[model samples]
Target: MVLLFRNLALLLAILLPQTVQAELVTKYDPVIYDPEVPEIVAIVGTIDARTPLNFSRALEEMPRATEVILASDGGSVLPALTIAREIDRLKLNTTILPDTGCYSACAFLFFAGNERASSGELGVHQISSDSGDLESGQLALSDMMDVLSDYNVPDDVIVDMLRTPPEEMHIYTPEQLATLGIIGTSSSRVAKPTTPTADMSKKDLAAAFVQDFNRLWSLPNAQAVDTLAEKYALTVNYYGKSLTNFAVIEDKRAFAERWPLREYLIEPGSTAINCDELTCRVETIVAWQTSAPERGARSRGRALQSLTLVWNGSGFRISVEDGTVLERQ
Candidate 1:
């Protein structure tokens, strides 16, 4: 992810001010960490003329990369298409992981995938020109549609993209992708480890994961950095704060020190889990009670938690954690 946002802006200005500006999280280079795609090429930021160069550099360095992961808001569609053809030429799978977003021309990069998957968000809208007449816009739009047809984007999806105004967006979540037959549940789904239905469904697995998270967090040792990092990514969007897993661990440690004793769990029947094959979004209500004898205080409350979890072969790991207090004492 681009932690150096200031540098990213300067880089974009130097590259092409009108077309490329990165509001993305990761990089356009070789990264072999993502569970899928042993050697992964992640293309984020904006797709400018230089995008193809960076992409080529990544592939030249990591020829074994079986997939390209994208999380771009978008940039020039022309350059994006150039990159897409390269991805196709190399026959790379494409994916979008949780907490990331793929939009506008970025959709072309995704559509060109040999095997596509998305656990994040994908958004589309009408083709736009910063300085062009209506006729020009129509011509551009028609050309875009033709190219998307060539890329094998679903007709309905393409229609939705064309219909969305340039200023607005039509967004598709992983669940929507599943409904569109673009994900694991799709008719074109390739072989994957069977999601054990007899033992536990995905929703059930999500609920249990959340419940276990709460159980672990209620412990005095909940702040154990390594333990917390095991469930949550090293980088997390905790509530709204961008925090490292260690920072979050310390935060929990402070809470435990303040409360002394506490119990927390997901409220019964309040779990709502949405999933595709690779990611899950779980929404649930957490009830908590805390006691601080030193202050002679007792507290009870409930909060709604929104969690984004991604599959890592054996189990899920949280990528985003957000909550809203629904009740407090």
Candidate 2:
């Protein structure tokens, strides 16, 4: 009888629902209810097998909610994937509020956000099974990878995930969260003056600046938004329209998602610069190719760009930018 009960207990532990415990707290915009600030549904507590069904019920009760906020240490891996699928199905944004954390299985929920974000802790580690069966653990890992792949998580991040053990977590730093396409959370870049140094001329500054700009622009990273925003003025004559830097960055963010792979080349010998006391005007030809493997889409082009820049004591900021495509494929 003792042996039978002991085996039964072990089996029950293995079969227990793996998920979270938490109430969905809703935050409304106002009595006036602004669509711009969509109502949020907060999920907090232990995650177990029941969380997905609970989430669905909560959504039904709060039909207007468009974002989900998560705070959890972790939960079962499979059910977290189920919740993530539903989040994706509804195109809901996921957030981890400042000071709160979403770790382990919660990372799956965070990434499923149509627009993922977090100011709080977001962490991941290898998936494991309670049964101590290596085969079951391997299957869980495979399933987790498949879900992450569906969400377009970066290959580098996946590598990090694979290497981290179940006992240890890889917590994402704020900059990593932002630059890795996990979040576009506001982060400032401090620009330093290079002109005061006797070793480099203004021409050299401009040349080096162009190289760094092109190199960063070519990366399939989310940091481009911050980098370009740092180099642009509050208002810009961008491509064609007069737009605020904020709007420009938003457009850039969307562009990055649409094309996760890119290559930008400043056509050799095609750059011209004219400078005065506090400003510079530059003209360059750039050839570019961008692709989205998930969507099976590719775009390639060469364009002539004219830019007007103003010195901000530290460096040049683009105030005007005009581009004309010379060729497209």
Candidate 3:
């Protein structure tokens, strides 16, 4: 009896942790950590329904984490959406390191990140149905839109993303992503070119954009992009952005143009301020509306557009265009 009891106790001890681990697995399964960025967890492999257990397990462990590195060929959608929401809640940065690819449901996960980035080859395709019919395709599109809406993706943009034929996928670059607001502006945090030498004649907006662009690609994540954008007085708005080659070009141009008129929201009692064409200025305006007198009055406000200014040897050039401003006093 003594020997039997001793064996039972030993077994209990061994099984306790396993049981607890199994319970945790119900919500989360497995997660991988990298020694280089110990704060960053690497999530690779099929992220489908089968993988959700591991994904959940990893998420519960990673909220306190700084980053999540994701790379997958694609898999399930519902689970991926759930995983993405957790990433957003943790406010952790989601990135795809260089040469890593995030496809299908994995791409949706990328959208959920507070900061989303892709090193290279970030592919996002339309959702398909198990039956592979137009009705199924429509259903899948509707579902993806719902998921994107939860993440604050603009309805129009989500619609555009779904435009891909059931047969084709939507691939994107970090810059293309930033414009649409699908990928946050945090990607700009990478590196930026400093003011040109005294003799340099031209504005290196392209170079500057490129520097930030590469940085985002190097460490794709929503936080990183947001950090960079904030440093430069830049912000991204995805409300009306879309996914298309032409749309991509237009978005980049919007960044390059940085027009205050197009960028800011104008309201009564608001003033626009575009700093002088010098002094590496950031252009923006503030506006606020007093509530009308009747019953209870409320205040309305909006922010104007902002420009990232840099000293060109000739003068100041509006090198970068961020999001439109809102009403603010």
Q: Measured by C-alpha RMSD in angstroms, how accurate is candidate 2? A: 19.5
TM per candidate: 0.46, 0.49, 0.45
lDDT of model number 1 = 0.70
Of 1 and 2, the candidate ahead on TM-score is 2
Which number leads on TM-score? 2
Q: Can you tell me which runs of candidate 3 are displaced by over 4 Å?
A: 1-31, 35-38, 60-63, 131-140, 185-329
**Which lDDT value does model 1 have at 329?**
89
Q: What's the ranking of the predictions by TM-score, best on top?
A: 2, 1, 3
- Residue 132, candidate 2: alpha-carbon lDDT: 72
* Global fold similarity of model 1 (TM-score): 0.46
Whole-model lDDT per candidate: 0.70, 0.70, 0.50
User: What tens-digit string does per-residue lDDT give for candidate 1 at 214-278?
Assistant: 87667554332224545776677888889887887788777778887888888888988899988
Per-residue error for 142 in candidate 3, Å, reads: 3.6
